[model samples]
Target: MKLIRIFFLCLLTTNALIAQTISGFIEDASSGERLIGAAIKFNNQGVISNRYGYFSIKVNVEPVRLMVSYLGFETKEIEYTITKDTSVLIKLHPVQNNLNEVVITSSPKQELSSIDHYTIPLELVKKAPAFLGESDLFKTIQYLPGVQAGNEGTAGINVRGGTPDQNLILLDGVPVYNINHMFGFFSVINPDAVSHVDFMKGSFPAKYGGRLSSIMDIAMKEGNLQSWHGTLSLNPIATRLMVEGPLKKDVSSILVSGRSTWINGLIGLGTLISNSENSTNYGFYDLNVKLNYKLSPKDQLYGSFYTGHDGFRNQFKFDNSVYRFGLSWGNATAALRWNRVWHKHLFSNTTAYYTQYNYNLSQELTSEKRYNATTNSSIKDKGVKIDFDQILSNQNTLKYGAGLVHHTFAPENKSYQNSRMDSTAMNTPVESLEWSTYLEDEYSITNKLKLVAGVHYMGQHVQKSYFHSFQPRISLHANLTSRSKAQFSYNRTAQFLHLLTNSSLGLPTDLWVPAIPNVGPEKAEQWALGYAFQLNDSYSLTSEVYYKNMEGVVEYTDLSAFLSATNIPWYDRVTVGKSRSKGLEVYLNKSRGKTKGWISYTLSKTDRKFASLNEGNWFPFKYDRRNNLAMVITHDFSSSKTLSFNFVYNTGVALTLPTSFYEGALPSNYVHDLNNPLLINYKFYQSLGDMSQRNNFRAPAYHRMDVSYKLTKLKVNGTRSWIFNVYNLYNRQNPYFIYYDQQKLKQFSLLPILPSVTYQREF
Candidate 1:
C-alpha cells in the first residue's frame, strides 16, 4: 500500500509541473458543425481533434506559432503566448474555388502521424454522376479502391472481402441498421443534410467496436447559425426539400429535411391511359431532423431523429379469384447527446440512442375460401456511452470510454388464416445484453516516430450463456523524409451479431441473428503496411497491402429455407467456418486546380473453408474479384459550367454451379405368391445432379463509363443549378447476374443506356 501511494504521489507531482495547456473545439464557421480529425500543430508537437471536435495539448510556457488545418477548409494560423492554461474555439472557413470538389488533403503534421483514413467533402459527392438522377453518397464511395458494389445500381457495398453487415455505419453518433431504400437502389442518407463524412478501413481506434471490416462516420449539419436558408430539388425518381435556421438567433438552431419518390404516381397515370385490369404501386420516403441548444459556455445539448419507409404492392384479378402481394420495410433512429468541458485539459461526452429496423411480407388469395399468410422480422437496439479525453502532457494523450447496449432480435414471425376458422401463429423473440470498455494512449516517442496502442474488453450475455473477448490494437508511423512516411498497424476485432442472407440482390428479408451458446462470436485479425508521399503541392500518392484472418464465420445450410412463412429456429440451420483475404491498393489524388480527381487500383484474393461443406476443401468467396480499376476526372469549363467523367473496370464475381447429372433408382420389396406363381415388384428412378466446389466459376468481366454536366446560375434570392447525367455512357450491357436457362447459361442486365436531369434551387 505504501509503494502504491508513493507511485501515485509522484504521478501527481509530475502532472503539476506542467505550466501551459491549450484545449478547445473546432467547427465550421457557417454551419456550426463539428469537424473531426482536424490537425493542430505547434513546432514538433501536435494533436488531432477527437470525434466530437475536442482537443487538448500541453506545451512550453512561451510564445509559439499555432496552425489548424482540415480538408476543404482554409488553414488558420495564430501567434499565442502559452503563459497559463487556456481555452479557445476555432472555426475554419471554406475555400471558395474548391467549394464543389471533394477535397481530401492531409496537413504536414498529420501526413506522418496517421494512416488508413479518408475524408470526403459533400461537394465532391454531389458532383458524381447520379444513378437515376439521385445523388448517392454510398455509390460515390464504391468508386474507391478496396470497395465493391453488390449489383449494377445498388447501395450495397462489400469492403475488403467482407459482407455489408461487417461495416459499422454511424449517423450523428447513432447506428443506422438499414441504410437502403427501394430494394437497394439508393441509400437512406439525405446528402443535403450531411456536413462531413469520415471513413476508416484499417488501424481502428479502441473507441470503435462491434464491427469487423470498417467504420463510416457521418456528421449532420447543425443548421445555419447566420440566417434562414432552404433548398428544393426535383428529379424523375424523387423530390427532396431541406430547411434550416436559428430558432432563437445564435443560442438555438433546428434543421429538417425530407425526400419522397414520385414513380408510383407516374405509374398510376400510365395505367389510367392504358385502361389495364392490373395495378402496381411502389414508393419510398425518408425524414430527418436535428436540434441544437447552447445552455452555457461549458455545456451543449443536441437531439437528432431519422425515419424512413418503403412499400410495394401488386394486385391482379382474373375470373373469380384475386391475388395480392405486398412488401414493406422501414428504419427509425433517435439520439440525445451532451457535451461538457470538465477542465482546461479534460473533455467528455455522453450519449443515449435507440434504433429499430423491421420488414414484412404478405400474400392473399380471394376465392370461395379465403386464405392469407404473412412473415415479419425485426431488430432493435438501445444503448448509452460515455467517453473522456485527457491531456496528460505534451507528448502523451489518453482516451477512455465505456458503453452498454440491449439488443432485441426477432428473427422471424409468421401467421396464417383461413375462412374455415383455421389459423396458425409463430412468434420468437430473443434478447441480449452487451457491454464494452476501452482505453488508448497516443505517445510521441520522438520527432520522427509515433505510436498508438490500445485494448478493448467486451462482454455479452444471452440465452443463459456468457462470452467475453480481449482485443488489442496498435499502430506505428515513422517519418522517412520531410515529404514521405511509412506506417504499420495490427488490429483484432469481434462481432456479436450476424446477418443471414441467401441472395446477392440485397433484399430487405435478410435476418439479423445474435450469438448464442451454440454459436460463437465472429473474430478477425488484420495487418496492414503502407507508404505515403507528397509528390508536390497539388498531388499525393498512397499504397497499402493488407491481410486478414477471420474465424467463426457463419453460413446457411443447404436445407435452410429463406423467406418462408414457417416456424423454425434460425440457429439450427447454420454452419460455422473460417475465411482469409489479402489485397494491395494504390491511389493517386490531385486536390487542386481546374482539373481534379483520383485514380485507384486494387488486386485481391479471398477464400473460405468449412469442415462440413465443399468436401473439406477451400473455395473462393462469392464477392471476390481478382483485379479492380477506377478513374474519376472533373474539369471546370468556367465559373458556371463543369464536366465530370468516371470509368470503372473489375473482374467478375465467383459463383457455384452443377457440373453433371446422373440417374438413381429406388429399391422396392418383392412379395412372392408361390401359390399364384406370380411375383410383383416396383422400382422408381430419378435424376440426380453433381455439384462442383463453392464459388468455383467466375462470371465474365464487367466494365462501365459514366459522365455528367452541371450548370450553375446565381440569383438574388439564392442559387439555381441544372445537372445532366448519363449512366452507361458507352451502352455497355453489364451483366447483373448469370443463371442457367434449360441447357444453356444466360445473363440478365438491369440498367441500360439512361439519361436523367435534376433542377435545384437554394435560398
Candidate 2:
C-alpha cells in the first residue's frame, strides 16, 4: 500500500509541474495608478482583474502575445510566453492626441473606436455651460464648426446653410420627425437617457437617408454590464430619474429613465394670486421611458416610449369662451438589433424599428348659443427602417441603408354657424408615402488625402402628393500638415413638406403640410470650402466660406387665413419664391492643460425674390443677421472641480414691422364721403429698409453670458461623489420671441432670465 501511494503522489506532482500559468498587474504608465477591471487577453483564453488589479489564467498553448486595454487608454501588447507560473506588470500610456477625437461607441465592442471622423467627443461637449442648468444636445453641437443655432432656447440648427428640417435626427436608429419641444426651448431628447451622440456634419455615408444637411445619431445606454448605477436630478423646469444594472451577472442588462414637469402647480399658484376664476389656466408636462435587454453578445433588443401633453383652459360658461387651445405631440419606437463580427476588421449591425408621431387639437364655444366648433387638425405617421455599416479596412469604410415612411393626415373637422344660425361640417383627408436608399463611402487615398462621396435615391408614391426627387453629396479633405487641413463639400437636397405659419413664434399652429400634385418640392444646392491651421497646441484657426441657392420655397400670403374648408386649395394661399444665402465662418480654438475655450464669428446674408412681391426684386429675409459671435471657456480649478462659462453676441433677427403710414382717399361715390379726399395707404420705411423678404427685418443686437460650476471626486460614506451645477449665474435676459398685436397696433418683446440647480451622483 505504501508503494502504491508513492506512485500516485509522483503522478500528481508531474501534472502540476507541466501546467502553464500567466498573471499580471495592469496600470497607467503616466499616472502610476493601477487599472482595475482592465481586460487581459492571451491567445483564446483570458481573464479580467478584480478591484485589486490582479489577474491569472491557465492555458494549454504557450502565450505568444499579451494584450491589455481600458477605456480612454492606449492599448499595449507584450510579446512573451509563460512556460510555467509567472507574474508580470503591464503599464499603458494615455492617448492624449486621439482622446478628444470623435468615437462611435454604438458599434460592436471590438472595433467601435476605429470608426473615426471629425467629431466633438462627449467629454469636450460636457465642458460647455448650459442655460437654466439644462444641457441640450443641439445647443452643445452649435459650439462645433459647420453648425449654427437658430433661435434662443430652440434646438433648431442650420448646418451648412440648410433649413432646420433638412437635418434628420435619429434616436436608436429610428427617425424622429420633430426634435424640438417647448417651441425650441428644449430638445425632445432627455439627456439622462442618452449614452452617446454622433453627428456627421461634413460627409455623410450612404446608410443615412431622408435628410440632406446632416445626421444626429443618438445612442441610448446598453445598461450597466458590471453593476447597478443610478442618477436623479431636480431642476426648475423638470425632475428626472434613471436606473441601470446587470440582469444576470455579465451576460444581460437593463436601463430605464423617466422625467416629469411641475409646471401645473406653478400655474395653479398664479391663478390663486390673481383671484380671477375666469382667467385661463395653462400648463405643460412630458414623460420619457426606455428599456434595453441584451439577449446575447451578438443580439440586443431595445424599446423606447415617450408621451407629452399641453392644455390651456379658458372657462366662461355664461358667455362664449373666446379662445381655447390644447396641443399634444409624442412618439413611440421599438428596435431589435443584431450585431455580428464577421472578422477582426469587419463588423455588422442590423436593425429593424417602428416609429410614430402624432398631434391633436380641439376647440368649442358655449356662447352664441350656436354649435360653432372646429377640430383644427391631427397628423399620424408610421415608418420602418433598415441600416447596415461595413468597415472594410482601416482606410476605407461603407454604409448603405433603406427605409419607408407613410404619413396619414387626418380629415380636418370644421363647423361654423352661418347666417341662418345652423352649423355645417366639412372634412379633408391627405396621405403620402416615401421610400429611399443610399450608399456612401469614405476612403483614404493617401496619408494626407481623404475623400467621401455618396448618392441617395428617393421615390415618393403620393396618393395625394408631389414629384419624386434625389439628393447627392460629396466631400474632400487634404491634410496640409499634422495640425492644418483643408476641406470642401457640395451637396444637393430637397424638402417634400412645408411649415405653414404666419407668426414667427415656433408655436404648434405652425402646421406641417406635405407637397401635393400641384405644389412641387422645395430644392436647395449648397457648396462650402474651409481651411484650418493650428498655431500651437493651445490655439487653432479655421475659416470657411459657403453659398446656397434655394428654389420653389413658399411664403404665407394672408396673415390670418384659416387652413380649412374655406381654403380648400391651401397652395393658392402661399406665394412662390426663391432665396439665396452666402456666409463666412471663422473660428479659433484654445485648448491647453488647465484652460480650454473657443471664439467663433459668422458673417452672412440672405435674400428672397418672388414674382408677386417687390416686382421680382431680391430682398432681405426677415431672419438675416449680418454678424454673430460666441465664446466658450472652461477652467479646471483642481483635479476634482471645473468652472465653465459661455457668452454670445448676435445681430438681431429681421422682422416685418410697420413703419410709416400711407395717404389714402375716400371714394367720392361712397355715402360717407362728401367728395372728400382722405389719407390713403402707402409703403413704410423704404429708406431705412435694409432689404425685403421673409427674413428682412432685424431685431436689436443680442448678447448674454452664462456660467456653471461642478464639484466631483468626493465620497460620502460608501457612495460616489456628486456633481453640483448652476446656470445663468448673472441672470442675462435672453430674448425668447417678439410679438405684434394688430389690435393694439404695437410690438412687444418678451425676455426672461431663468436659473436652476441640480445634483448628480454616479456609482
Candidate 3:
C-alpha cells in the first residue's frame, strides 16, 4: 500500500525531528538536601535519581553535555540548550579535600541501576565498625552478602533464609516495628539522623509490599537548609543529642534527635557498692523528629516522628516479704508527606502514616496471701499512600502505587489476682484490613538491554478471614561490556504478619501473629542470578545466586512455650510450614583509596517442613548456616586519623539436642487403689529426654573480631571526635546458649573482650 504509507511517514518524521527532553532535580549545594542517587549523564545516556530526587531524559542533540554525579559529591558539567523541553535544578558540591583524597574512581552508578540493589552511603554508614560505640545501621546491614546475624550482640537480620520478621523496616516512610534497641545491642537507627540506605535484596520493586524477605528503605535528615547545626554524643552505653536549624531560611527546616541509656546510672552505682536491699533495673530511650517545607517551585512538605522505650525493673524486700517485677517495650512512628511536580513528566507523592508496637508485663506478691500478675501486647497501624512518577520517552519509566492499612492486633492480654477475692481476665483483640496496588515499568530495550516489569495486588481482612495476593515482578539487564553486567530476578511475596520467635535472644517476648482462618498468609518465591564487574578503578564485584520458596511458614508449637505462653490463643499455638532456601553470594566493594572496606560471602541451605513438624521430615532451619564470612577494613591515617576492622565467620546454628535418657511409669490407676482390694502401691518414675530430630545439632563454629579507632579535632566551635572500640577483639568464645546442668554439657557466652568509648561534638 504505497510502501506501507511510506513506512508510516518515515516513522512520524523521525520522531518529529529528534524529540528532545531533559528533566531534573538533584540538589545539595550546601544543604538544600534532595539528591537521592544522582548520576545523570547525557549523550551516552544514563539516569538515576528517584526516591524523591527525580530525573528524566530523552534527547537527540543540540549542544548537550550534562554529567552530575554523587558519592561525596562534586562532579557537575553542564551545557544544555535543547530548545523546547527542559527543566533543571542541579547543584552538587561537597568534596573539599574529601579526607585528603585518594579516591580511585569506580562509579558503579548505584549498581548500574538496581536488581538486587544495595546503596549504603551515609558516609559508609558513619564509617562502619561499631557495636557499643553505637553507630549502627542494622549493624551495617550485617556486613552484606545475603545478610545473617542475630545472636552475638544481635541486631537481628537474616535475609536469604528470611526470618527477622521477613524484613521490611522503612523509617521515614514509616513502618518500623521494633527495630531494636538495648536487647539487640543497639539499632534504632541514629547514624547522625540518617540520610540514605536502600537495600532491596532480590528485585521487588512494584513499590514494595508487605515483605517476604527484604527491603529497608530508610531516609531521614532533611535539615540544615543552610546553617544552624549541633551534635553531641558520648558512649559506654549511650547518650546523644542532635539538632538542626533554619526554620524558614530556605523555606523551613527542623530536625531533632535524642538517645539515652546510661547503664541506668551504672546500675545505681552497683547498688551502692553491694549494700543492696535487692534491686535491678535497665533502660533505653529514643526520639527523633523532622519537619521540612518548601511550598513553592512545585511544592513540598514532610514531617516525621519516632519514639522508643524499653525498661525493666525488679525488687524484693525482706521485712514485709514482698517481691515485684516488671518489663516493658515500645515503638511509635508517624509520617506525613507531600511533594508534587505534576508537569515536567509528572511526579507526585502523598503519604500519611502511623505505627505502634507495645509490650508490658508485671508480677507481684506479698507474704501472707496476695498475688497478682499482668501481661499485655499490642500492634497498630493506620496508613494511606499514593505515589506516581511517569516519564515516557527516552525509553519509558513509570511507577505507581496505592495503599491502605488499618490493623490492630493484640496477641495477648491477661490479668489475675488472688487474696480470697479472686479475679481473672483475658483479652484478645484483632482487627485488620490491608490493601495494596502497584505497577512498574522501566524499559529501554536496546543500547544494551534492560527491563523491569511489575504488578502487585494484595488484600487481606481478618476476623472473618479473607486474603488475596497477586504479586509478580521481573527484572533483567544485560550489558556484557563497558565494565560488565548481567542480572535476572523474579519475585513473588506475601505476608500477613507473623513473628513468633522463641528465642535467638532478641527478646521482647516476640510475638506478632495475624493471618487467621487456620492461619495462612506467608509466601515467598524468589530467584536471583547476578554478576557485576568493574575490577579496577578502585574495585567492585558482585555475584549472586539465590532461590527461595516458602509458604505459610510459621512456627512455635512444639508444645508452645514461647517464653512461657499464657492465656493461649495465638492461632492456637502456631505451626504451618514449608520452607527452603539456597544461596551463594559474594560481594567485594572497595569504593576508593584511603583504604575502604567490603568482602562478604555466604553459601547456604535452609530447610523446614511440617505436617506438625519433625516427623514430616525436612529439618535444619534454626537459622541454618553452612558458611558465611565477612570482613571489613578501613584505614585513613591522616586528615584526623582512623582505623577499623571487623571480621566474622559462621557455620553453626541449627540446634535441638537431647539424645537419650529414659524412665517413665506412674499411673496404675493412680498408684493402685481400685476399690481397696489389695491396696499396695509403689510409684516413682519420670525422666524422659530423647530429642534428636528438628534442627538436629550444630552450633559451635562462630568467630568474631572487631576493632576501631578514630580521632578528629578542629574545635573552634565545631568538630571533635574520639571513638575507640574492641568488642571481642580476640576473646573467641562464641556460643551463646546450650545447657543441661548436672548431667554436664553447658556453654553460654555473650560478648567478652569488650571495650568501648565514644565522644563527639559538632556545632
Candidate 4:
C-alpha cells in the first residue's frame, strides 16, 4: 500500500515539476478557416483538434519536434524550443495538383481507416449525378455500406433498421428538426455552403446525445478572410447563388447563400397567363448565412443561421363554389458560439442555440353550406452548452461537458364549420426541461494500444413525471501491424421524443411527442467490431460487424389512428415494442491518382416483436434487406474534363399487402329486398392492408445507374462549367411502392430515365 501511494504521488508530481504545456489553433492557409479533427503528434503521441480547431498538449520542457496533419492538406512540422507555457498558430496548405478527396474516416489519424464512421467531402459529391441537378448531402451518405433509403428519389434514410427520426442531424452545432423537402423527394441543405460532413453510426461520442442510430455533424464554411468570391448556378428545377467575402480584411468574414425552386413559380405563372381562378402551386426555398470574427488570438466568435420552407397549395373553382387546400412545413435554427483558450492546456467552447420545426394545414369550401378546417403542430427547443478539452499528459486526455434544453411541444388538431366544431388538442401544448452532463477519458495504454472510456447522465421533466438515464461508453483500438489495425466499441443511446408517423409517404402531418408515463423513452445498445488493412499505398480495405437492440419504441395501431379516435387518449392508442438488428459490412477504396472511387457491400437482418400487434411474434422490419451493394468511379480525363458513374443494387424491401378478399356487409340505409318501397337493396365493402403479419411481402429488387459529365472553360476573369447528368440511365421501372388496384397488385415508379443539364459561373 505504501509503495503504491508513493508511485501515484510521483506520477502526479512529475508533470508539474518537469513538463510544460503548448497550445494553438490549426487552420487553412489560404482562407484562414479553422480545421476540425486535425492531428498533432510529438514523440509519437498526439491529440486531435476540437470543433473550433483548438489543440493542447504537455511537452518535455525541452527542444522537440511537432508534426501536424489533416486529410487533403499538406503536413507540417515545427521545431520548438520553448521551455514554459506558450501558444501559437499553425497553418496547412491544400495538396498540390489533387482534386477533392473523400477520406471516409472518423479516427484522428492520417489514414482512411475508421470504425463505423465516415467523412464525406462535399465537393466530391457534387461531381456525382444528382436528382434534378441538385446535389444533396443526405443522398450522398445513402451510398455508404450500412445505410438504406426508404424509396426511390427520397431523401429519408434508414440506418441499421432505425427510423429517420432516430438520427440527430445538426448544422453548425445546432439541431435541425425537418431535413426533407418536396414530400421527401429532396433534402433542404444547400451543398455549396457546406464545408464537409462527419457521420458516426457507431461508437457514440460523449458530447452527443438524443438519438439512437446515427449522428450527422455538418459544418459551414467560415468565408474567405483574404478576398471576395461569388457563384451563381441554374438548373431545370432550381436556381442558387452564394457570396463570401472578408468584412474587415483579416479579422471578420461573412457568407450568404440562397436557393429557390422554379417549378411552382412557373405553375403559378401559367395559371395567371390564362386568367384562370383554379390553380396549383408547390415550391421550396432555403437560405444560409454565417459570420465569424476574431476578438484576439485566444478568443473568437461565430454565428450561423438557416431557414427552409416548403409549401403546397391547390384550389378548384366550379360555378359559384370553390375548394381550397394548403399545406406547409419548414425548419429554422440559429447558433451563437464562443471559443476561449483558458490556458496552454485547456480549451473551451460555449454555445447557445435555438431550433424549431412546424407544419400547418388549412382547407376551406364555399357553397350553400360553408366548411373550414385548420391544424397547427410545432416543436421548439432553446438550449445552452459548454464543452471542454484538457490534455493531462502524453498518455491521458480528458473531455467533459454539460447542457440544458427547454422544449415546447404543441400538437393541435382543430376543425370548425359554420354550424359545428371538433376542436381538441392531439396531445396538448406542454413545456418540459432536459439536461445532461458527461465525462470521458482517452488514454494511450501503450505505444500501439488506445482506450476511450466515458459516462453520460441525462434526465427529462414533463408534466408530473420525470425520467432519467445512465449510460456508459467504451472503445478499444489496436495497431496489429504497420499495415493492419483493429477496433471494438460499445454505445448506448436514448431518445426522449418520438415521431408519430401515420403514413409511409413522409408527409408534413407527422406529429412529435414526448415521453409519457406508460411509454418510456426509446433506448438502443450497439456493439461493433472492425478490422482494416492497407492493401497497398493506393488502396485500403475495411470490414466491420455490428449488433444492435432497441427497446421502448412506440407506434400507432393504424394509419388513421391520429385524430380518428378523439375519445381515446393518444398515448393509449400506441403500442410499445422492441427491435433487433445485426449486420456485416465491407468497404474498399482507392484514394490517390486521377481515378479514384470505392466499392461497398452489406449483409444485414432486422426484426421486431410486439405483443399487441403481431401476436407476440417477431417479424421483419420495413427496411430489412438481405443484401446491398454499391460501386462508384470518377475519372479526370483532364483538368478541364471530369466524369463520374454510380451503380447501386439492393435486395427488395418488405411490404404489407392484403392476401384475401372478404364478403361485403349490408348498408344501414338499404333493405335486403329490392321490392321494398321504403328502401333499396345495397352492399358496402371496406378493406385496407391486413396487419396480421408485419412486412411479410417483399417487393422487387432495386437497381439503377447514374452518370455525370462536367466540361469547364477558363474565362478571362473566372471560370464557367456545364454539367450534364442522367438518372436511371437504363430506364428500369423499379417498384417504388406496391398498391392493390382493380383487385390486383400493381407496381408504381416515380422517376425514370431522367436527364438534366446545369450551368455554373464562379468569380
- Score each candidate by Cα lDDT: 0.84, 0.61, 0.82, 0.84
Candidate 4 ranges with C-alpha deviation above 4 Å: 1-18, 61-63, 96-108, 111-113, 272-277, 419-427, 566-568, 670-691
Rank candidates, TM-score, best first: 4, 1, 2, 3
* Residues 421-504, model 2: lDDT tens digits: 655455566778877778888777776777888887777766644477777878887877776788888877766776565445
lDDT of 3 by residue, 368-436 (tens): 888988877888999988889888866678889899999898877777787877555556578899999
lDDT of 4 by residue, 13-109 (tens): 8766567777899998978889888898887677778778888877784686889998888999998887567788999998864354643444555
Clashing pairs in 3: none
Give the local distance difference test score of model 1: 0.84
lDDT of 2 at 711: 64
For model 1, what is the alpha-carbon lDDT of residue 742? 50
Q: Estimate each model's TM-score.
A: 0.93, 0.77, 0.36, 0.94
TM-score winner, 3 or 4: 4
Total clashes in model 1, counting residue pairs 3 or more apart in sequence or in different chains: 0
**Number of clashes in model 3?**
0
